[model samples]
Target: MQDTVRRILTARVYDVAEETPLDGLQRLSARLDRPVLLKREDLQPVFSFKIRGAYNRIAQLTEAELARGVICASAGNHAQGVALAAARRGTTATIVMPTTTPGIKVAAVKARGGNVVLHGDEFDQAAAHARRLEAETGAVFIHPFDDPDVIAGQGTVGLEILRQHPDPIEAVFVPIGGGGLAAGMAAIIRFLRPEAKIIGVEPVDAPTMKTALDKGEVVTLNEVGLFADGVAVRRAGDLTFALCRDLLDGIVLVDTDAICAAVKDVFDDVRAVAEPAGALALAGLKSWAADHPGSGTLIAVNSGANLNFDRLRHVAERAEIGEGAEALLAVTLKEDRDDYSRFLTLLDGRSVTEFNYRWSDVGTARFFVGVALKNGPAEKDALIARLIAAGYAVEDMSDNEAAKLHVRHMVGGRAQGLAHERVLRFAFPERPGAFLRFLASLKPAWTLTLFHYRNHGDDVGRVLAGISVRPEEQPALTEALGALGYPYVDETDNPAIRLFLDGARAGS
Candidate 1:
């Protein structure tokens, strides 16, 4: 640990990196009733702090090693860092990325003078292939977050924070993926600012480090959510895991919506949009503050800003809910026009962010409504209670993953005559005509009932569709789906769908 601190103090990454500013977030601080500081690593040349580690490791390589070149596997920010660092050193770099990586990232790597190799479907597969290439080509393979040099390089952020803020820091929130940044920062902060808390934040669906610490060993996750693709590693590095387990004061897990809210918060403070993984620390800090109010200087590392432009819509849609400023509810009212007016009257001037209504039967109609909340969850709860007391059948859709991701946009009348409808959630490549190709793969004999798809600007498109087929045709339906060549999950009985679409008539 001492050696790591010494190495971090002398890391030679400044040749291609900058000492990003530690700016205070006034708006957030005021809201949280504490001083909040942002370590703006997003301002780095490659728009990520990964540059610090990548450049530091590359710069120290022997001339012969440089001549042989470097190789790495990354889906996003790390690839950009390696490419930019290698370019600065006037050496060749080969970046192996998953075939599912966004085109924008691939182009960015190429623009930075790195040879791009699209291989496999995820980071693990691409990394395995990179290792094979390294053996075959005699190139040095750079592990994104595992090596000692990388950890020491990333430790510089903590060193800077201590130097930049002479005042005592109550807590330092760092985002964890494979634990590189958190390990590095925790090591330095534990030594230099022993009194300060080192908190690690991870996407709830990809809690690699948190799970490792809990289990007392690094365990690979069966699957990880890709919303925060930069920190979507299924397993933590051995070295990073060890450091984080020992040095981190605590770990916080946040969801997709919270990350989106943090992105909005950062943008509001600095007018800079942060990628989901980049805002993990801020989200954790917000969660911590809300749970345990205290007056102290809270530091959050704004790790990267490599956001895909098209994803802004999804982030914006969920931000309010994440911040407890919006509530999504499924309310049932009589089909009579007077009932609709009565429901509106009960709102009492609370602005509705969204309203989707569909008359599925003669007796009852369902409305998917998004209402603004002035006082967070308490307000949302009170509103729901009030509506329920007033004889409205309501279901809170705020925390329903399937509802938030798909059903909200697909609210409509029930499909008529589609017997034995089976709904499935599919993840397929997002390309031109991808949906049409999926439709074409199915036989015309099967009736399509429900279909909903929204592009989140990710490598894959999420689709929810229902197909009607008899029991005898199930085998053929399975074959057709297998032939479609996309990962899918059976959601035929998903409660959200049943409540909003399938059960509507039953209740009526």
Candidate 2:
């Protein structure tokens, strides 16, 4: 522990990384009824905290090691860090990244003078290839999070936070990916500000650190979500896991909606568009504060601002629901203008964010509705109760993953006689030829019954597709989908699928 602290105290990060400001978040502080602070690590030269660890690790490499160059596997931000750091050291960096990585990040790394290798479809695959290349070229392998020097360099963020805000804090929230930042920051905060609680935040789908801590060992996840690609780790770092297990007070898991809400919150408070992972700590902070309300000081790390320009629409769409300020519902009503009028009257003039309706059935109609909420869940519940009392069937779709990710976007009447149809959502890598490759691999015997996809400005495109097959052909269908080499989930039983409604299900 002492050795790690010493390394942190003298980390050679200043060569490229800056000591980012601990700025106050005025609007957020007001809303929470406490002083909220943000460690603006997004302001770093590489626009991320990865710069510190990347530079510090590179700076300590032996002359021979530097001469041989460095290699790493990263989804995005860390690759940029290594590229910029290695360039400053007059050495080359070879970054192996998944083909699903955002083009913006790929461009940034290339612009920083790094040799880029786009390989595989995910981080683990890319990491495996990087290791093989490292062995072949004798290049120094830079692990994204586990190394002591890298952890210590990230620890510098904690040091700056303490120096900038000497007063006691109720809790300090840090985003956890592979745990380098959390491990580093927790170590320093434990030593310097014992009273300040160090909390780690992770995406709910990528709870690598939280799972490890819960199981009392480092364990590998079979899969992880990639919306917050910056922190999408299927496994936690070994060294950093041990450190975080001992130092961090606890870890919090947040869904992508909460993260999108945090991104909006950061923009509302500081006029900065934080990437999903960048606003992760703030999302966790908001979740915790909601449960433990007080006028205590809280701080969250704004870790990066490298979000692609195209992804903003997804953030904006989900942010309202994430903040509990909106509700999405699948409602059934009698097919009459009077019923629609009564529905509006029950809303009490609340703002309607969306309303999707088209005649599907003669006597009954299903509508996908979005309404603004001023009092969060309570108001939403009250609105739902009002609808039920008015003889309308309502299913709250706000928290439904399939409903939120796909169904709402494709609201319409269902096909009358669709049979043996399976609805599936797939993660399509955003690259040239990817869509065509997927199409070429599909079987011609099965009919492509329905297809829906909307670009969310992400490296991975979310696609909802329906395929028709005879019951005996199920095995063949599975095999064909597997051959496509895309991640997918079956949404056949989802409430959001209107095909499961009365008319469609009756025909099938």
Number of backbone collisions per candidate? 0, 0
RMSD of each: 12.2, 12.9
| lDDT per residue as tens, model 2, 1-508 | 6777888999999988887888899998988899999999899877899999999999998888899999999998999999999999989999999998989899999999999999988788899999999999999999999999999999999999999998879999999999999999998889988889999999999999999999999999999999999998888999999999999999999999999999999998889999999999999999999989888899999999888999998899899999999899988877655565677668887755556554533677677787889889999999999999888999999999899888886664475665787878888886544545665665666655554544444778777667668899999889988988799998887776754432356434
TM-score of each: 0.81, 0.81
Candidate 1 residue spans exceeding 4 A from truth = 414-508
Q: Could you tell me how far off, in angstroms, the CA of residue 506 lies in candidate 1 after the best superposition? A: 24
Please report the candidate that would top lDDT against the real structure: 2
